[model samples]
Target chain A: MRGIFSDGPRTALTAFYWAFLLYLLLPLTLMMAMSFKDASFVAFPIGNWTLDWYGKVMQDKQFLDACLYSVMIAAASMVAATTLGTWIAMLIVAEGIRGRMIIFALACLPAVVPGMISAISLRIFISTIDMPTGTAAIILGHTVHAVPFVVVMALTRLRSMPGNLVDAARDLGADNVVAFFRVTLPYLGPALLGGMIFCVLLSIDDFVRTFFLGGYRPTLPMLIFAKVQGGMSPEINAMATIVLVVTAAVGLYAEYMTRRARTR
Target chain B: MEPVVQFDQINKSYGKHVAVDNLNLSIEGGKFVTLLGPSGCGKSTSLRMLGGFETPTSGRILLSGKDVTRVPPNKRNVNIVFQDYALFPHMNVAKNIAFGLELKGLDNQRIHRRVSELLELVQLQDYAHRLPAELSGGQRQRVALMRALAPDPDVLLLDEPLSALDAKLRQQMQIELKAIQEKTGKTFMFVTHDQEEALTMSDTIVVMNKGRIEQMGDPDTLYGRPGSVFVANFIGETNLLRSTVLGVEGDTASLNWNGITITANQGGLTPKPGEHLYVVLRPESIHCSVTEPATGNRIKGKIRQRVFKGNHTSLSVDVGDGTLLNALVHPSDVAQLSGEDIWVGWKAETSTVIPDRQAHN
Candidate 1:
């Protein structure tokens, strides 16, 4: 009875939880608040607020072009990574396939490698291969990094999937191709969606790899980095706050979808 | 007519361990044939082979007199109901049922008609729009059955489909499954380790042991006249009395048990004189009495123990010479037995004898 409802430990745990949440959100909250500051420079003080900075960031042609370019690259890399990752996951889960553990480890290596090390290595690789630094190179680098996340997520879901579903389909007169498309693909839908969204987020937030593999055209992260080099401004904060909110919403939706799939 | 399915001298071995060894069986069409054995005895393996999921190691499988040893599952005219009731989670009951029909290039109208008819047969018409996860266990099982039956394959394979249900629901499904089989008149190859399930639903039961067929017969024959000691022990509770055959007369053999000479049916075995054999005596066949009445074979023994089993009382009688025989008595008749000493008797025709094969193997 004493252990059931101990108020002393409960109070301590509640205080710790709130402290952790505050620590995590305080920086992001400050950045978002600064986006509404009326002053041209970013500072911590009680000042007048306006939406002029957001409007300016939204109207900047260079910022809009960088955002569009980053979106196109993310879209391309998401498709590539999802396809390759899902295939590798299926191969790992398939029966009679030897060296599956080795394959899975190799496929997931990129996710563990340091971002700077991977970026430097990719820069060297593109130079050695006589390929120029551009959108294609950036897409390739992003695909390599994002593939591991997709593989890990899809493999986890695939492991939980019942083996009999495919067998039942084949027994009901479906060929291997048809069975995979009709049964296996639909079963992997939620995991693939989550993985693809994660890939998009990973690509959009990546800077080290893009820094090493950029052409004349700048991406959103590169553009923001270039702008930050000048000085900290509410306009830059406004742009970052927009990216942050959109990415957070997308991440939440992915979590919601996969969680719903799991419950179903 | 040719057999619907035949395993011609099939052998399946995974490296050193043989899952199936030299199995030869022919299944008749429109009959409920069951492969009954313990797990790893190759009952499910045999059903999977017939379903074209597993290939035999050294022999051929013929379906309707056509060799299908190399045909894949999709090419074979067979469908299976998996134990887990592997219904498509993404599709509703009606869509799941129409999957096979759609693959077969059936028009939407025909597929829709077939799906509705199957749902109606299983009394799941209202559940046609529900997902597999939304249905009860019994309802999901019915959906799986209807899904496999949608295409109307030549044979239906059930790999312990009813094992997942609760005891009472399993019993109800057993009767429903038999009724469905009779109404469809389709060739069904079922596999189960539960002998009662095999006995209740199968027209022919194949008992397997150590990856080999021990016996295959109708339920009545397998129960009343089991060909082997394993079959006798596996099918139901039975007491084996080890004895030596004195002589064979007609279809009966005279066995010398302790000092009492008992005549028993030979059970298709012509044992030579002085041959060791076991008399398979079902507990229900032995009647317990206080007085040694005019009977065929009587053994005077003490009642070691009595267990009241609702309808009948099971008594363990200690016959002389370190022998304990079990007998079933009615509760009322058991109440009359006041003394520990009693006489247990059974007719000569009721007990069957099989030669002891333990030492030879």
Candidate 2:
């Protein structure tokens, strides 16, 4: 047993880790490589490579409009989700709150439920309420999907926070409203920022909900899906590559910001 | 002048358990008072009630002769240096100190001036720009103190603020805290479980037990003349010798021990003839000798154990019937008591008598 648990590296674990990494990166690498292919079709064994597909993707008015449209929806949903989620998180973590466990479970239910199921239910609910299917419906749907992530992140931060901070604020002559804005909200800054960014990323890539709720105007994912039905092309790969790079960069920046805030 | 703070028949109960029971206390201005007790002794609860953190079930709390029972904590002119310091992590030391002043609607210039002056109070002027997370423990403590003092509150409440520091730091902070109290001349209501800390810092100490005040007086009075067995044991190390009172003189009582007759002070307690009592004998008051001295109360016993405590040697002498009386002696006295038999003695004025309630049953 000591020999098996020795300080030396385990070859089997190393092999399995590399295999997992390769499996995860292989498809992403292919898609990126195909974006640079000169051929119009997205097939292997490309004879030539060029930047023409990227140039065309950049010039496409429909792609640009779709990008802007998706961003606006993500922003709207993020704002609503963050505000509502932070309030719910605070309610759950507060003292003398009855049935906290049940409240937390319900708050986090959207995150655990299947996206397809949530999308279908949201569609039916919106129709029942006589809400038109457009930016409002898509934002409503995205906000519901985004809320649980915000709640979970904000809840984790709130639990680790010392209760004394608020007490100290009150002792120093701050009323409830002032104390929340001055002390509690500032303390929850990093968590809320991370959660908002996560909401944006989640809303941007959410296909099922947008597909179900969207009307005439198509988002980036919807536009990409429409283009894919026509034919798989290097232009589509270029569009996907741009989105992948941008989202990955945003996610990384959020991670860096949270880490910096934590250390500070 | 009236008292700075007063608690009138306060009682705080949580569900079925009473935390503080009918507590009435008046704290004078410019005095450092400490509520000292073990955990669950209601010391903290009483302080919280005074600070407007906890409302009493039935009572009124007055601040400088104003009824503040229903007032919120922010409305009260009382500030607390919380046990954890509770400095805002996002705010710098200067900003943390300026928080209360800003809320008072002080202009930026005065707030800055006041914050810097407070920083100089703890000699942390250079650390004004530093965040709380960047500060050392003692520095953070000073910042917390300065923050509480910034608003010139009528009363300052400290809840075991020094308990988190190391031994040396705690001792240093104790002196600093007392000095700050003297300098500011603010009524300080400190709550702590450390008896030594209370004795060192408090102008007046209120000893609490079981949700009630056990005794309240100056430190010397509480230590030298404890009213009950709990106060006697809790304030300092002492041995309680169960005895029956044979006779009583003015301010003195003759007690009959297991087989020895001893005389002790009444300690303001009146007892009649044939009454059961316990004589509270401080260990430091007892002297150990090889032979019985010609004066004071003397008892013969065998030396059961000896512990060398650097400054003095602590001896546990078994005085028959399984009763071990502890006595502190000089290291030189231990060599002379090598024999089996030893005489432990203390003056009659040094020991006090208390009625043993179990005898009534």
Where does candidate 1 clash, by residue pair? Answer: none
Each prediction's DockQ?
0.86, 0.84
TM-score of each: 0.97, 0.96
lDDT of 1 by residue, A1-264 (tens): 566367788888988999999999999999999999988877879389899999999899999999999999999999999999999999998889999989999998999999999999999999999999999999999999999999998998888888889999999889999999999999999999999999999999999999999898999999999999999999999999999999999999999998898788
Note the Cα lDDT for every prediction shown: 0.92, 0.92
Instruction: List, in order, the clash count of every candidate structure.
Output: 0, 0
Task: Encode model 2's per-residue lDDT on A1-264: one tens digit a residue.
Answer: 567558357867887899999999999999999999988778889889899999999999999999999999999999999999999999998889999999888988999899999999998999999998999999999998889899999999998899889989998899999999999999999999999999999999999999999998999999999999999999999999999999999999999999999889
lDDT of 1 at B141: 92
lDDT of 1 by residue, B62-126 (tens): 99999998899999889999999989999999999999999999999999999989999999989
Off by over 4 Å in 2: A1-10
Candidate 2 chain B lDDT trough over 10 residues, lowest sum: B352-361
Task: Give the local distance difference test score of model 2.
Answer: 0.92
Q: Assign candidate 2 its CAPRI class.
A: high
